[model samples]
Target chain A: MIRICIFMMILLATYSCNDVLDVPSQSDEDIVLELWNHIDRNYCFFELKGINWDSIKTASLARLNVSTSESDLFEICGDMVLALEDGHAFLRNGQTNIVYDFKEGYDVHFDPIIVEKKYLNSSFQREGIYTYGMINDSIGYVYLYGFQNRELFENIKGYFKQRNPQKLIIDVRNNGGGDSALSLEIVEYLIDEETKVGYISVKNGEERDDFTEVANVVATLSSNNYPVKTNILINRGSYSASSYLAGMVKYIDNINVIGQITGGGGGGGQSFELPNGWVVRIPHHYFLDAKMNHIELGVEPDVEIENTELDIMNQRDLMLEMAIEY
Target chain B: MIKFDLDTYRLRFSLTPIKHGVTGLMLMISASVFSQSNKTMFFKAGFVQQSTFENRLTSNYRGGVGLNLELGFEKTSEKYVSRFSLDYSKANQGKSYISYSTIYKVDLKYENLKRIHTIKGLYIGGYIDVGTMINEKNGLWGSTNNPISFTQWASLGMVAQYSVKFKNDYLWNMSLSTPIVSYIIRPSYGSVWPDKFLEPQNFNLYERGIVTAGLKSGNVALFNNFSNTIIKTSMYFPFKNSQWHYGLEYSFNRIHTNEIKPLKQFANTISISFKRL
Candidate 1:
């Protein structure tokens, strides 16, 4: 009885919704369906994805081998995730940042240069997030510590546009996450308007790829027709729209994502109070890159640099140096 | 104790950051910034007698001291009680068979009840501690010639305790104490073999300074002799003004060595401490 109570308490502590209390009643399929309904209603862009989710879910679930392990369920769930074909769409557990980069047959591999980064700061310290600094005089650096306001976007774009530096290094090494629209708004100056950044697809167990879309970078700069030379510095820690911004920029080719690759795809986190009142964030949506490639493998880095104790001792900004030299 | 004694002597002094408007300050003259009100601080000094059930034959009795600090916060209202505290303790036992341990604990506790002896006095609280231990002088006999080794290790644990206060004043205070349950993991002795030996590292600026001064003063002998034990000895030093709080307290402790199934035995000790709380 004590163990059961402990288990229930833990389950309650971990689950974020009233429906989560009914998790025991629902099979894996029912849970997936429930998540799909929740995301379809709440995702920032559900209807725009434009895919038939039910058929996609049917196709994806049909591929499952009916295994009774957590991994098998994850694999089945992962296979279901691919139906969206939008690189930004994915499902992930918190265990490992490295997921099967679905583009490569969803093969298990190390988190891409991008996806391993989620560790810059476990709790992204909410200090001065929009603080701007200059590195090597050539790179205009604006560290988006937290993505809170449009003013941060305005600060970066305005700084870059006014200075018109030859190369701009937007340091997103520490950005945990924020608004995707805010990120997409910043991408406007870097990419041409007609350029299709990538697609975002959502899937349920039976409703596979219910939503799909080809989102265009709506940043005011390029939408207003100003393409600036940009290089966004990403560490393993960047996530959410920040990771999306990196992948979207990677597809455009004009923007070189420097530094180590990111800890690829992150699930769209939903905040909910567990039955025990412990606030939790559960990731519900998985994202991919423009080529229907899942970045859960993380976006690859143009240059790979490791942070070592020796580097800190010597006071080296290896990423900035690599970007400047490149 | 694996302390980080910095090279400089630094003192931290904090002043209230909250500002009161002129009208607010004038309206409440008694609640001035420098209210001589009681911001309660409790320092517990006690000792324990520890025995090893597994290694009784080889180990001897141990007597060591423990100190804990409790810092109170401004009450939000008369109905609610909240406080944040940093708890630390150090204990040492035996002459050649010393065990030293230290813990840095931070916890936010809330009192569910205000009145004493009532059912509402049933309080629940929890605290988390990250600490380190060092042990010297192992084996059944107090022989320095044994193939003993000193260990430096860290541990993490949580504590839940319940108590009802009889007298809540700084002096003449009394309370019945009982721990709900506290879980601690002491890493297996001799786990790190030849390649990975334990060495002490500075944990903070103050400890770094102490270490540097000790080293400069040629006090390597102090550490070299008592290097093998797992408990922290610095916390057990019988000094009344050892920490920030002024209090009087007492405790009992028991510690023992880890050995083979038969040879090792237990070490026990008891201590009584009186200080400003």
Candidate 2:
């Protein structure tokens, strides 16, 4: 009995000795290292962009010191992540917000005023996230400003049913992306058969290349198959889900993309908090076009056309005009 | 008969060897007939205070004050003892995140009792325990409302217990169980939310119901990537001719895995029990 009791005591003592809760207290340097390591492991565009993440870490660390305030540290961290050149990567502190400087730097190729007055014959109707009308009594025009409102797709389908125009123009030039699902919902109305839209791969492990097997993202054609000649207008300001839409439309037969290259952000964002309570949003999945091309560098237009200052001065949207002519 | 002194004869008759043998025989017979093998049924209710930490849900360990209720039955024979119990607990944790969890558990145990030397009221035993636990947790944000976040474990383990009977049939028992094999079910990482099953396009009336939703989340697993340990101690004081007992109990359990996060739970309770034999 004494021997058995002693053995049981030893077994209990040794059972979970290694299971210690060791959440380390973070110093400023430790926070930087953690942030760097987080990006090194989880960020999806590192390989595609050919960025040396280690050099970014070293450069950021050189700028840090004991006298650096919390906000300064936040900025340094944000700058380190912005080096990835992905618009989906972002960080925010109390007074500072960091995002890829895409909008202010790119030239404005789309003017809503010109599009409203000249293209739609000064008759623009707004329904949810969609602005639609008939251009010259021949082309159906729908300008999607965002992808959040799903009901707009159904409404556009109804409008197309009523008009039955020979050509359709979809102006998504400055449509900063929202939901990818809603983008597919819009594509379903135009496609006539099951289409392999693209592929999506996610991080399955902590390693950089520890990605899951790529899965084909298919968009099934909806019952409303309005097979008019479709022209999608894209520009350097078209981003995220809008860029994804550009990639999808390239596979459909009746669609032709016009204008400048899209501003690409082809991954989904996931948010994580730092030790000091600031949030960092990183892209964790890679979206590939049907040709297995990484769309992180933006999709090119089928017939590249740039809007000039003269075109804007004359109240002409050249891209919309091209779509109308096509 | 022979001319003997009356006092001496009386002493001899009182001290006879045969008379003492007959008395010893009768006591042995009565003891053999009325053995201490019986069955007992008990119901218990108590206030419980619990603390839990689940890293998948939150980073901090949260404490809650709640109620614990239990019903149990035990059968004891000369060689072994069998026990079955049903227990339920509900608690709310945290103030900001505000997590709430309810757990229902059922356990059946069989122990082979062994007598100990040098301790008159003590017994040492090895037990086989089979139990199932279902726990649901939800909070203010994230995937709390999703059914996939709920946890269910079907466990089989070996237990070691030391039980002591004190004066007037009072009892003290301490047990420790480490699950050698467990089947665990949890949500997959970055998958569709469980509410997708409740949507109109994919809805089934039976599966979308509240009760069935909780049950369907349980997936079978066998000794792969999951482990747990449970320790419980209790004291019972008999009253009213040993027909009723009052108990105080404390239990601690920790479960962890590489796939999901680790969870630790502690419960302290005081209960009233009734025993039927």
Candidate 3:
């Protein structure tokens, strides 16, 4: 009887719809200040990327006044997000979604028309999330759009056991990135030891540079030994976890990094809620190679190459041709 | 789908999520442990009107209507009574159309009250309650801005009740409860989660900051960072001259927490039940 009474009573109490809480509205200036102050205290790349955060805040706060509307505030906030320059930064207010990207005014260094016709025309096959085949009978090739799929590496392990090639070319162009552990998953299949690839840290204070002690990002060896010479193909489009991959494999003695420096996004995307119920995304975690060299600007390649439009017209992919020969 | 087995006293649920399926299986197994006792089982449903405000997300209070479901068992003796119950409720409420929040809570509790008065039916004792409440706002951004507020709390509280019996055999009861201490597990202010275990390169920043953060529980004073107060009124009388009692019950609770940011919620609920005598 007591338990039934308790349940019925609780059910009875739930039907009262009372408009009791009174919350005041925030002004446009307050919203701008909220965005600016949050990023100023928490954003991790002000010093590393040489951003003038104070000046950006001043410019944004200057745009708001007595007559500034919500749309105007949205634009102002969007501009500030763009000024952060990292692809992980974003702003959303239930209506508009905004993000910062770094794919302007630079050579893409890749062309689908050239690769499909020249390399994968007859070998148009996909296993799991991977597209792989032979560039020829002697060399193996696998091109990934991102590290969003870990099965790609798992499939690579199986592919190597079956048709073990003398060389393998890994392409990560325009791979915007995903979990960094997927990068280590690929490295584990290639390396022979528990090697430290990079360092990982998170911000712990309001200071721009305040962070936790860096933990060693290590990749251990797998049991099956497929001792193929590895070449990682990169470009300005390879970013974030892919850049992290390039940074790690470059330390391996047998691997050669071939192409332009990867488009850098070395931070993990983190978010917080604003007073107006909007979400603000920013880079909060930092990554560095084992030697304490910064990876935010990108991982330098051993063989820097770019695809020329003229070369594309001549049906020559010098990078792919180079991977086939190296 | 939910299937009940009366002979073995168990419930089986085929849920794709797998996690929920495991939890349901565990709940049934627990029910089977106490199946030998002579007890009255009750299932009840009612409506809930709630108003809540969380400064971590916003400053405004949002109100919404929702349905409540509760199931439990009770055993009564001349000296004392015990109750074990679980409840799940969900509601959609917000200030703006796009500012909506999907809030759901599954609460489990066990309490025992001992009769303190010899002449009158008055009880005084304690209860322990544990609940996890998750408030998700604006599903527009998938998994990112969801579960905007989360709190897992275990409370030790005191309960008091008084009853009056009329000559005609109808009984009226009133009770009040207040938490004496609470242990809370909540996310810190800055970061929530991307992927909890798979991310080797990420850690929550506030874990190393001023306040200590972990999965462990801490002993907090009554009303320090958390408080929940409940009041209830109920009536029981003869039902159609049979060996059953008809009852009407009303319950109210106010839950408040300011550990990281202020979140205050109030619920008023009512239901009717039949008790086997």
Top candidate (TM-score)? 3
Candidate 3 residues A259-320, lDDT tens each?
A: 88888887766555566667677876667887878787788888988888788888888887
- lDDT tens digits, residues A219-250, model 1? 23343334656778776666555677787677
Model 1 TM-score is 0.34
Winner of 1 and 2 under lDDT: 2
What local lDDT does model 3 show for residue B196?
A: 24
> How far off is each candidate at the interface, as Cα RMSD in Å?
26.6, 25.6, 12.2
Candidate No. with top DockQ = 3
- lDDT by residue for model 2 over A158-237, one digit each (tens)? 87788778888888988888766666666666788877777767665567887766666666656777767889999988
lDDT score of residue A174 within candidate 3 = 74
How do the predictions measure up, each by TM-score?
0.34, 0.64, 0.76
Tell me how each candidate scores on DockQ against the true complex: 0.01, 0.02, 0.13
Winner on DockQ (1 vs 3) = 3
Candidate 1: RMSD to truth? 22.2
* Cα lDDT computed for each candidate against the true fold: 0.38, 0.63, 0.68
In model 1, which runs have C-alpha deviations exceeding 4 angstroms?
A: A1-127, A204-226, A272-280, B1-277
Rank the models by DockQ, top first.
Answer: 3, 2, 1
